[model samples]
Target: MEKTKDKRREKISVATEIDRLEERRARCQDNLERAEFRSRKEKLSEKERQELIDEMAIMNERVQQLDNELKMLRGENRRNMLLSVALLAISALFYYLFYFEEDL
Candidate 1:
């Protein structure tokens, strides 16, 4: 049915969005590691060091936000799965009552 197709599309979209956010988080983590290595390995002026620190802070915040978003999305996915199972069980019960009970 049309509603089923729409639900499927929404789920796929959410899954893709989650994947995109995870990839972005991975890139941010890589950047953080490189920045830390640079700070430890290179001698820089005070301004440059402070700028690096600020940049790292921003990236850290973004990573945290991404993690929160992923957690929310995963929880939503779990809820959807539970809803689908409940629906299937209800449908099966109805089918059995309507189609099989008369034969008994």
Candidate 2:
């Protein structure tokens, strides 16, 4: 029972973490879009333009990092699900062999 509870908690935490990261990625995308629009719509000093470019680069890097992390988390979640299914199957087989086969 305790192990089940722990597993449930871990699954929930991973899901929530994924949600948080997705929200951050969305916000970063929005910021990048706004920055692009601003760069196109307004004329700015060279230094300011350079700063905007640098900021955009940083945002892009962060987005890439977030993408990688999200991918890893999703893969881990998939593996966990597969492992759970396998374990359940094994348990069922054991129960059947012990309980039902003996009566036959």
Candidate 3:
């Protein structure tokens, strides 16, 4: 059904967003590593080191937000699938009780 297809599309879109955020998180981690290395090798000022740490913390927060969003979307998709199954079963029960009763 169109509704099921729409749900699938939405789930796929959410998964895609999660993947993008994961990739960005990986990049952020790489940057953080580089920044730490520079701070040790080149003797960054305290302010410069703190700035890098703050930036990494912000990136980590964004990654955590994406994880939470992914969890919520997955839960929604599961709920929709359960609802579709229940509806199908109820429709079948109705068909058997009413539509097929005349043939009996």
| TM-score, every prediction | 0.82, 0.81, 0.57
User: Candidate 1: lDDT over CA atoms?
Assistant: 0.91
Taken over the whole model, the C-alpha lDDT of each candidate is 0.91, 0.91, 0.75
Displacement of the residue 37 alpha carbon in candidate 1, Å: 1.2
TM value for model 1: 0.82
Clashing pairs in 1: none
Q: For model 2, what is the alpha-carbon lDDT of residue 24?
A: 98
Measured by TM-score, how close is model 3 to the native structure? 0.57
Worst 10 residues of 1 by lDDT: 8-17
Runs of candidate 2 with Cα error greater than 4 angstroms are 1-12
Residues 1-104, model 3: lDDT tens digits: 99997787666655575566567767866776776677678866889888877877786777677677667867776787799899999999998999889888
lDDT of 1 at 45: 97
lDDT of 2 at 20: 84
lDDT of 1 by residue, 1-104 (tens): 99997787676766787888899999999999999999999999999999999999999999999999999988887888899899999999999999999898
Most accurate candidate by TM-score: 1
lDDT of 2 at 14: 72
- lDDT against true structure, model 3: 0.75
